[model samples]
Target: DAGVTQSPTHLIKTRGQQVTLRCSPKSGHDTVSWYQQALGQGPQFIFQYYEEEERQRGNFPDRFSGHQFPNYSSELNVNALLLGDSALYLCASSLEQGGGYTFGSGTRLTVV
Candidate 1:
């Protein structure tokens, strides 16, 4: 079965623009998590979704939002983008009962 899948492997956006990144979870996984990874830095947790509700969020500002669908697919939306937002956005999926996570290749977003 396919692991998590993310869309638009690379993107370029201008400041103040908005971007939506997508993720489809692996088979049988019911939870999805998003992360942002700057160059030379480890991934920082953004938020997590389960049962179509945001279960937890990290230290990111309100510009970041997410949604999880019935099928366990998810979307990460960023509004009023800033150059500092440029980074590799990662998607991970795991069972709600706790298990190892499967991550996607990640979407590379660059804000100018």
Candidate 2:
């Protein structure tokens, strides 16, 4: 199944370059939300996907995008990468009740 099979991990991408990060949920979760967290700062919501379609989005630009597969696996694609984008990219899977967000242990992405 496309469900999660293990704990989520971090991904690092270079500055000014595009990168694709992958995450699979074993909890039978269909919703995937992405966030960018800078050092000493709270996580900033990027966007969320459900049922293989874009559902909700944060203030991030179009450069931040994502996709959810029919199998429940998800991908977060960052385009036109910039130095300011340096931070932790976290993927959370939940029912979108607006609470109880399950996320990976801070994935640090440093640019430069």
Candidate 3:
């Protein structure tokens, strides 16, 4: 009955620092995907986790990583943050069938 939930609705960080964002997926879901959206760009796939394993990854650098738990929750980690890393981090969840998905509003990360 619950939808995807993301934490630290807004965050501020300095370059060279690492930040971790969290997410709780919707019920009856077993997969979680992470995305990063710049000010004027579409969301870029960060990575996806299913059954606690990373199934797919986007063009992001190694600095971007994610994890999925048995409870269907997830987390996104970015290391050595850069000013350009600032963006909205979204968490999406759905069944492996991929019929549909639910996305959290996102955590706004601002790197200064």
Q: Which candidate is the best by TM-score?
A: 1
Worst 10-residue lDDT window, candidate 3:
64-73
Model 1 C-alpha lDDT per residue in residues 27-93, reported as the tens digit of each score: 9999999999999999999999999999999999999999999999999999999999999999999
Q: With candidate 2 superimposed using the best TM-score fit, by how many Å does residue 85's alpha carbon deviate from the native?
A: 0.7
TM-score for predicted model 1 compared with the true structure:
0.99
Query: Candidate 1: where are CA atoms >4 Å away?
Result: none
**lDDT of each prediction vs. the true structure?**
0.98, 0.74, 0.92
* Backbone clashes, candidate 2: 2
Q: Please write out the lDDT profile of model 3 over residues 1-112, one tens digit for every residue.
A: 7799999899999999999999998888889999999999999988999999999999999988888777878989999999999999999998987768899999999999
Better structure of 1 and 3 per lDDT? 1
Better of 2 and 3 by TM-score: 3
Number of clashing residue pairs, candidate 1: 0
Candidate 3 to truth, TM: 0.96
- What lDDT is reached at residue 64 by model 2? 83
Error of 1 at 37 (Å): 0.1
Model 2's alpha-carbon lDDT is 0.74
